[model samples]
Target: MKRFIKSRGGMTGFVLLAFLILIGLAGPLLVPFRDAGRHWHDIEYWQDSPAAVPPVWVRGPWNAGKLARSGRLQGKDPVLFESEGGGGRAVWRFMLSKEAKPMRLDLILVIGGEGKRPVLVSSVGDDGAETEVARRLFEVSVGQPARLALSLDGARALTVTEYLLPGETARDSPSIVLVGQVSGLLGTDVSKRDIFTGIVLGLRWALLLGVAVSFLTVMTGIVLGISAACWGGWVDTALNRIYEFFALMPILPFLIVLSAVYKPSLWAFAGLALLFFWTKAFKPVYSMALQIREEGYIEAGKSIGAGKMRRAFVYVLPALLPYGFAVMALSVPGIIMYEAGISMLGLGDGTVVTWGQMLHDALVQGAVINRLWWWILPPGLMIALTGITFALLGRGFERVWSPDRGSRPTGAGPSRSGT
Candidate 1:
């Protein structure tokens, strides 16, 4: 732990990976404010906002022309445009600290998320009576925010509000400017699916697939490899042929076909991976087992009439465990990549929310073209981070087991090679 922390990359990776592991174990509880039961699958029911909403907190700079409730304004950009249920009036209050020259300002009404909803824009006086400033009806597109030109002269105090012309209260959320408690922090997908929650839940699937596949594949390899090498003759020859045959098969196509044929689930993919992944661990385990066969302890056990099971598993397996563990650690990334690849390719179970599935949805939804960057970036970053974490852990262990590695203590030796 000390040595790992001493290495900056390793420490960063460890912290990130640890958080993700906790996310997997705790499920959606990490984001306590979010609805735990509502996931990517349940997105359709609770998609209150328009699809492909950008993060609420991170909008472009609101310029001088945009009405201000409160906050600094920068380069010309859209201010948050929102209306209450029944398309009620939304007031944006602006204050003037000093006498200012009158300047013409254009306030464009950008409608987004759901579709064209006629908005009634008007200025308000101190008495709370609505003034007919700009009461023109304009059609707006879904997921596109368009502003109507409302040029207002400079004033000490200005109250600008929008009202929805009497119409059906939009059941679906407004397409743009959705950033609040009910909406997710990271915003919604193209389907108005909560990307934050999807990411949270996807952690579970990622950790499950990675660890389950690695441990199972390694364990299965150990059993088969040791058994074949110990029994020798026909058993060894047959198992070797099977291993070589699988090595030559097209894994991606096979998995794609498998997903197409069977009901896709986490366990189903895990089981399928068992066929291919074990061989990677199998060869090394068998080599170690064969080497162990010549040891005096094994011969002594045989001379004492020890059973093959006891000799192969009880004695020989334990000796190969360290090497087996290294192989297992190295193999984790491949399993994760495979699962993610399949998920990205649309070969994943629709109900399941994995990192790859998120990417798949984003691509299909044209998130990149729309510049909804939040949807595309996070999952890819997370996948890379997870891989880095495991790689650090695997390398740390490999150093621990290296023959020339000194035991002087972590961060101790100037020249570890000599020691």
Candidate 2:
């Protein structure tokens, strides 16, 4: 732990991972007040629509007139355009404080050519397309905040706020200036309950089930492996070879064959993984068991008239435990990777919300390449962190159990008291 804290990268990674897991676990609870969930979705939308929305100052030095002069302002450049269009989009930069600022953009809307009011006066894109709806001219006020509905079906309604304020700029990104109020830029419908609660609940179930299945399957393999190794001759030879044969068989073909015969479920995938994963642990554990069975302790147990099962369990299995755990530790990351790969291939249960399934969904939804950073990044990061955590924890435990590792007392090396 001390070494990890001292190492910058290790400390950083560990801290980041700890916080990420905590957030994944407790996000739904803390979301109402902290409002990080809004930030997550807002960041996602900001990045997605313009690819990467720069802060107000990051827009570089450009006057309002310069945007029109540049001829680069049209839908040709994503930074300036609200959406994919042929014409230029109007953008604005606004300040929230002396140091804090928001960026804004004006989207031009063309109302019917009856000298009527403009359809859209918000942010305009290069395509010259703006959302428009029928307006009732019961009252006309220039600087009043009002709720208006756009005629475009499914289009999110916009609140016209701060429409008259000039956009300002600081180090932060742009903000949208409404007609009367200085509110935030238009955002998505993502609520605190929407993104986090589902994700948190989904991930908790997935990871918990994943760990349980892995532990059970791996432990079962260890037991079978030990049996194969200790009871050599026919028992060892036949079973080990049989397991090896199964391990060598193609997984995809097997999944197809198996899923075809029965309905797909999380259990089915876990079972399939166990079948193959157990095979992987067999060889190493069998080797350890073979070695352990020949040790002096086993012979002593035999000389003392210990029964086969008793001697094996008390003496041989205990000796093999260290090696068994070491091998198991190393195989965990591989197991997770393999499971994810199989899930990605669509062999696993579609309803199960494992990290693997998440990746598969991202791919299917086109979010992987769609620049929806939050959607893809969160799942990918989760998979990576989970693998790393298991690997590091396993390594730490292995070293702790190692004869030559763990703590060494001061001046404790090689005592010569007998001399």
Model 1 TM: 0.67
Stretches of candidate 2 off by over 4 Å are: 1-199, 260-262, 401-419
Off by over 4 Å in 1: 1-14, 32-39, 60-184, 405-419
Every model's TM-score: 0.67, 0.55
Please state every model's RMSD to the true fold in angstroms. Answer: 10.2, 13.4
lDDT of each: 0.65, 0.48
- Relative to the unseen true structure, what is the C-alpha lDDT of residue 401 in candidate 1, on a scale of 0 to 100? 39
lDDT of 2 by residue, 232-313 (tens): 6798788978887988898767876787677777777777777776776677666666766666556666789887787657
Looking at model 2, residue 155 earns an lDDT score of 26
